[model samples]
Target: MGKKKVSALVLATTMVLLSACNVNMGGGDTASKPADAASKPAGSSSSAPQKVVFWHAMGGSNTKVVDQMVSDFNASQNKIQVEAVYQGSYDDLLSKLKTSMGSSDGPSIVQMYEIGSRFMIDSKTITPMQNFIDSEKWDVSQLEPNIAGYYTFGGKLYSMPFNTSNPILYYNKDLFKAAGLDPAKPPKTYEELKAAADAITKTGKATGANFAIYGWFIEQFFANQGSDYVNNGNGRTSQATESLVNNEAGVKTLAWWKDLIDTKAANNLGRKTDDSKKAFSAGQVGMILESTASLKGLVDSAAGKFEVGTGFLPKPADAKEGGVVVGGASLWMMNNKPNEEQKAAWEFIKFLTSPKEQAYWHINTGYFPITKKAYDEDSVKDNLKKFPQFQTAIDQLHQTKLNTATQGAVMGVFPEARQIVEGAIEEVLNNKKSPKDALDAAAKEITTKIQQYNKTVK
Candidate 1:
């Protein structure tokens, strides 16, 4: 649990062009060592440690956690040194990573969002984590199946799940009580949620609810309805050639969301998650749908103001009860690196996913640990006790069934498809078009993009 100061030198160098790897080291200036060198394995000796560059998209408080974890890993080992680099947002990281391919300076390990799984696989520039696991015969039974399910396809885990999260319903318990609703009995189905929202609005306790118009949430709704986002078994059994977001489930989900906005039960926050979070934390909204990763921020923002409560995301009453897809990023090892570098990167990944490190990560950040063993750790248990709301996310994830819909849609153009979905949502909320029409148009466009992507990958 010791925090280490991140070297400014690494940050300064990392900000340079993505294609550049040369770092200017003053005479006798080796990479800054951790303050506690005693943590290094005893009697372990090696030549110059193999350096691994890790490019990640984590920012704000999450970036601090990544730096601390990297420092801890570096301190605990003597044969490998990892330089963690902040590579802007997830989209920015993907762009830069694509352009840096085939260059000698590309990162040895990169963190990409879950939606980019198919693209990473098709790029053919990644050494699938499954390859390493299979070669070493690593026992991965302890890994969270629901989280691993998203990154796994064709019976292989292409990337290592890190910073995994799932969406949940976060509500202001004080606001619920003021609205004459039981804070302990949060809404479970769409009908219940609507009723609660209406009561909350009528009582003037809060603005009922609000959530960002994000495609991820739409996808979750589809999953909750047991519907696929794309054909070809949600793009798991084979390559996805088209998008299925225009189906009946998609139409129903969008109609419900539009009704909520039109009825003034929920505010249309557009695509700015921060705006929605701000509204909820300020007690202006009774409930909000957001990733579990927002727990820490929401709690801190509402501290001494209101009590926060969390529950599984609401599903349609008529739909079969289903769970959510994992959101967040995963770690992928870059291909074509030197054997030593590849092995070193894998070692760092293994260390990061270990029970102790995962527990520390889960406690510090709101992200769920990918390993089941992490929850059994004393540190994790203590943190869970302090904030029992965190356990709701675990329970929600545990209830998730391993199915095509829950595995999430996979396509080379998934990022673009998400943007299209968001655009369609805006159209519906703005009353420019009905849900079915908007979704149909979006599905058509996404299908074309997917077909084009398939051709290229083929």
Candidate 2:
């Protein structure tokens, strides 16, 4: 959703959706990952029913649910006939969206990945949701603030969250018990996590940990340490013009990540989180970091084999300030469409966020409901009773200190920046460069990309 050709030099491809699409499993890559669980709430349009085209990137079972929800919406009213089209993965959808920029045939509403927010806002092809929120006096208080915070920029909400998630620490309890370690005691800090990994490795039962070399995890680590990913309040207060990942927080994170693999306590699973997931489920690894949306799948995967334990994402022992940022994608209403079409899409959007729909979404898909009221639903309550692992994510989310760091960084070149960071991490982990050297070079490249992006968006 960029206006002009943006940075992708490091990626060697067009800016693909390396966004939090299920973060690939729930928000990772979106393809190899399980289907995204998302639900929308209700609103009504008294006007004549119009054809509202919704483009989404959901695949597998998640796609079926999204389609069913659309069917339900279509059946419930005649004011809006929504054609929910599956536009491949987030990567494919983004490519298609960019190509369809000048045409009026694009979707009235599109579900874009979270990291694409900055690009979407700069493209000026989408109408900011705040316009409708203010015009209708919608009480957005019903939405979760943490989820809402990621979509908010320049003091306005740019998109409506559809399927949202955050990362958590997943450990194999059976492995822990086998190693004679307390299964109840998952790691709380970097040092503790390392110790636990060492214990697990030393026991010869399983490897200690296997965290994917994901830039999102890197960003989360920075947030956990109360550090910024870029300048200007993580690009919330004003336009970001530089990279901040080469600082002390970044060096420490990369160094630790490399050390974990180097010391043989953790496995270097490369950038694919699914490999780590496989290792954890197979009892080859004790702990892994992944999206909360993976709860149901991880539980189901480890069933009959081991007990799965959920804990908050690990941070440095000294990290007392920052928290996690919401992963997953959101609904952006296109500005190219008519006001009525946009309004119809809003009705559908409202319906998706409704407490009833959200409950169904959470119960079936593992995505945390966007609305607080959804928790009150009996079905949601029942689902939680069945899978208490969700409580860990809930507790972690509530415990997070809302700040600029936790709000997450926004940059038009974010996708490229993430890829660049991964390249830097790989360089250090492969012993090609020192942590500071790799990061400094990556930061320089990201800064150049940011400057290019700022020029175009301005």
Candidate 3:
């Protein structure tokens, strides 16, 4: 819970990195300058398949699935051949992309994290997906509204949704049964969740409910209460100038979480998601809140040990049935390419997002398919039949309303803001500060960072 102090040299190095990349830590309008085009290889033939390069940050099992998807796309047609390249983590990819954009060596398409949307748009190194959709008159009606809502800004789809995920409550069914709670009925509200955790812990079936001290859950909890994460309509209508995490919703959320930990109904698992997941899978914890993307790992880890059940993220008892925000990365097309290359990249993107491909991706990686029609695909249907727990995330996405709060925040400094919020959560959880005090301090710090970033970009 203690804050780590950064040395002056480290801070200076970070500033240099940010400045070198021309990255504004706060949201801003798109740049007016055009992107530089990569030169075509000499003597390239028009009749051959146009090679399109794609840079992604997926690793481990996700890398395997993405590789298979790319291979399948290449084998499916001859008009375009995509070369999917692994580019390390999302932060690494973003850094490399900034360097590549400075020259004309960037990939035709890139997988950017949701938090990077505002930065990507402002960089003006990519074309909006809406342009392609409008030009082709493609019907995007099949895309999930909730999934699309996160990447859409100002009524425009900026990127193609892929590998979308939402947070869900994963509970140990056997623990619930042993605790005399209904294994079939999971908690739906903050109060209910705490009660169940308390009962389970008291019965000694498990230690308690546990979750990572992650900011994404805080964001979801705010959305469930229909509260904006930042000003200017969650940074959709205009640039966000400040954070609202110190508001009533935030205080209530952090207070409830603090109470749970204080009463020994939950454990402070720190910031590592895997730690909490391991605890849950090992039956050390009765319940956990994690991304839907973890469904496969949880199920596999709990095999022959216990049954894992899932439900939508818990909401406030008095709050309406507001929804959770979408998480995960999206596919973005780089601009300033030759017509053939651009078209080829678009074709590859279309193939990747198609129902069949998305179904395969969903089944293989446990990520939710962005397209609604993918749910009806035989593969997805079969997977759902095998693991009905995955259905909760899909249903949660459907129930979500396309509001600004649920659409998520769009600040260039969003990644930094998340870290700040997580630090505040640690402060409150460790009793170093009150929820309001901790959150207020974090909001102040984030506001200063946002102001400083906007000034540099301007």
- TM-score per candidate, chains pooled: 0.89, 0.90, 0.91
lDDT of 3 by residue, 1-458 (tens): 00121222332344456667776432122221122235343114566878889999888777888899889988987767889899887767776876676455888889988877877776666778887787667787878888888998888888998878889999999999988899999999999999999999998768769978988889999998899999999988988889898999999999999999999999887998889998998999999999898898899999999999999899888985578899888988777555557667877888877889888988888888888788889988899889989888888888899899899988767777888999999999999999999999999988887666555444
> Per-residue lDDT of 1-458 in model 1, one digit per residue for the tens?
10111222232223232214432211111111111223333223456788889999888888999999999999997878899999877757776886676667789889988877776776567777887787677887879999999998889888999888888999999988988889999899888988888888888767899979888889999898888999999988999998999998899888988888888888887787888999998899999998888888898899999999998888888997567999888998877565557777878999998999999999888899999999889999999888889889999999899899898888877767777888999999999999999999999999997776665544
Best by TM-score: 3
Question: Weakest 10 consecutive residues, lDDT, candidate 3?
Answer: 1-10
Candidate lDDT values, in order: 0.81, 0.82, 0.82
Regions more than 4 Å wrong, model 1: 1-46
Q: Which regions in candidate 3 have their CA more than 4 angstroms from the true location?
A: 1-45
The per-prediction CA RMSD against the true structure, in angstroms, equals: 7.9, 7.9, 4.6
User: How much does candidate 1 score in TM-score?
Assistant: 0.89
Instruction: Give residue 454's lDDT in candidate 2 (0 to 100).
Output: 75
Cα lDDT for residue 116, model 3? 77
Which order, best to worst by TM-score? 3, 2, 1
Tens digit of lDDT per residue, candidate 2, span 1-458?
11112235522222232231211111112211111123222223444557889999878888888988899989997767999999887777887887676577688889898888887776657777887788678899999988898898866888999888899999988878877779998898999898889888998888999988888899999998999999999988999999999999999988888889899889888888888889988989999998898899999988999999999988888775888988889999877665656676888899999999999888877888999999999998889898998999998887888889999999888888888998999999999999999999999999998887676544
Model 1: colliding residue pairs: none
Off by over 4 Å in 2: 1-48
RMSD in angstroms, candidate 1? 7.9
